[model samples]
Target: MEFLLYKVHGSMNTFFMLEGEEREDYEEMTLKLAALDPGIDGLLVVLPSQVADAKMRVINRDGSEASMCGNGLRCVARYVCERDGVEEAVIETMKASLHVKKEQPQGDGIAMYAVEISPVSFQMADLPMAYGGETEWKLKPLPFVSEEIPFTAVAVPNPHLIGIVPDEYQSNPAHQQKWAEFFNGPNEYFTDGVNVSYATKVEGGIFVKTFERGVGFTNACGTAMTASALVSCLAGLVPYGEVAVYNPGGMVKCSVEKNGSSFRLRLTGNATYLAKQQFKWEGTSSESGLELAEELQEQALYEKFIEQTSAVTNRFVS
Candidate 1:
């Protein structure tokens, strides 16, 4: 019944952190909390060291579980570091090890945190894509989606299909949604599962819209960001090594290097801290958005809570 909630604002997105309860089924809690706080776009769970056997889960606000999330980990790492006062910490997720470190605080009250996502995989066993068994394939024109597209298929702890879109389509919401539907819709091609991305190059970096599996189109996605950067580089869209990924949620830094036949992706960013409180629900529950907002407002003390806690500032290149 008891839970600890932490909130973090990252480069391009926001995350809700959950911890403290040993018996709480986090997978279920993610959905419960998302219903309770619809404003939250993503959720991260940190299992106690005592219960190391339990796998950590990251759930999108829509109640879909992602195999891995790059931006979410940075935010979660920042939350953990701020609370534990440790410069470096290791937080385990559903798939890989998230090594996080807190740097010096900036003047704007923003503290930078670095997170290293394990690596990338292209083995048919690793990416598990039904297509040819992962022989270093780039996203080429595909008739399946009925689009002649240049894409990159990589396994950066998760399977993703990253495609570059024209500048015109990049800014169009309807076009983005159409692609999202194609990747997530009922189809025999990506039966096991796949996330699709439409990326466009801009002045500073690349802007991407991702239709993720388990979760639909979310504000930001880490693995998608990594795949975008890699695909961009391989297709000569961008330089290799470090790249900027702009998603609806926020911006994330992606770094990649050739590893044998595939590549490795490392994402780095920040997570913010939000207010924490206890919730007492009575009577039948309603799934209406208005009801959830009302419940959250009751727990929010506003001015009083702000006075008690120091605000965590967010800084972006924009």
Candidate 2:
């Protein structure tokens, strides 16, 4: 069968989109494809949604499936919008149905899209944590990573454990090493494990680095950024409003608002299409063959995206 391969990036977290049938070996395919690109965070399978305009299945590099991915949704939004010639669409994910709209373009061929991420909760049960009483868990230190570092657990329909650290530690190699250990280490606190974020307050907003569950370290984590902003507001560091979030990948704007006892979030960022290629599926097993066409790389478009992002941010990218 014929499949269109698109390398899409949202806030620097790259994902390979395979637009085709829902095969039984998708898990295997995801593992294979993700292994081919060290920069790739995961693989996204695009399928027709029964409840919304389109359905996206997020498969991590480890062959595990994520309930939802904010960044992936934005990229899929762009894909569907361009295909359907529409500005708005509702995408069905494993956890919730998300509404996405194409906003003003960020750069040449770089479109900005905003997605509504909702059904926010802070209860320990929602995060599926083993500890915690009736009160929401916030600013509590866990032994898994560090006894001194306090963490807030929140689920923006996707479990995240956010830790607000000093500005110096935001990009510190030692802290990044600890983050990597905590997520990959054998920890009892986060029974099923959680996406971990270390955030630091910056001049305009906050900068965050994330070690995602099943994906290890990524250039950026959209949901983690949103969760970090929410934690920032709750901690009184920032007001409940639009917060600019910068990561190693790039920048994204998040709007965090409190409604009643809960909070709602909206994420706005670039949905950049880097390249498109053709892949041929051979068989149905894990060992099944898949061949990529020789002309798979779209270097021009990829370079343009990198150049535009660099120019707009004026941030040096190695």
Candidate 3:
């Protein structure tokens, strides 16, 4: 069977989008394709949704399914927009049905999209974290950390444990290495594994690095960034407004909303289309491999988008 592979990236976290109804062995195929060279963080299977414009199934490289992926959602929004000739779309994820709107281009070629992330919660039962009988959960230092580093658990429909560290620590390679180790290591509180993000306040907003649960150190984590912004606001680091979130890959803007004790977030960033190619699907099993019929030709465009976005981000924040 012929399949179109659209390689897209949002804030440097890349994913492959496959349109059409999934084949019986699509999960295995997704795993194989995501494991390809240069690597991909996950696969997005776009299928028709009765409740929305389109339904997205997020499959990580390890073949595990995720409830939601903010970066992936942006890419899917752009894809559906271009294919359907529409400016907005409602995408139904595993957890929530989200509203995505196409925004003005970042520059000449870059496409910008904003997605509404909601149903925010901080309950330990929602993160499904193991906790003793506690009425409410708040930010506290992890038991494993040597120093007193406080962490807040927030679920933007995706579980994230956020720790705000010093800005200098974010730039240190050793600190990043150690942080990743701790995230992946065994922990009593998070038995099911949770996405971990370390944030540091910057002039404009916050800089974050994420060690994702299924996917390790990615260039960026959209929900993690949102979670960081929320935590920063709660900790009195930044106010509830437009917050500039920078990751190793690039920068995205997050708008935080707080009403009484509830919160909501909107993420705006580039939904960059990198390449499109035709591939031949041979079988329906895990061992079934895909044969690439063509090469990816949009490397220059991808690089240009990265350069231009980074420049804009640096000039604004620096």
lDDT of candidate model 1 versus the reference: 0.62
Predicted candidate 2 versus true structure: per-residue lDDT over 139-180, tens digit per residue: 777665678777898888788888878755554547755665
For 182-253, candidate 3 gives per-residue lDDT tens digits of 655685666666887888877777778888878888888888988888898888889999888888788888
Q: Give the per-residue lDDT digits (tens) of candidate 1, residues 1-318.
A: 344466555544556666654443445555666666666666777666543222356777666677777777776676667668777887777666667777554324445566666667655456655555446556675555547567666777777777777765655557556755765667644555777788877655677777777666666677787778877877777788888766655555688777667566677654545455543323224432112111233122222322321111111111
Clashes of 2: 0
Report lDDT (CA) for all predictions. 0.62, 0.78, 0.78
Residue 232's lDDT within candidate 3 is 88
Ranking by lDDT: 3, 2, 1
- The lDDT, on a scale of 0 to 1, for candidate 2 is 0.78
| Candidate structures ordered by TM-score, highest first | 3, 2, 1
By TM-score, how accurate is candidate 3?
Answer: 0.88
Each model's RMSD to truth, in Å? Answer: 6.6, 3.2, 3.2
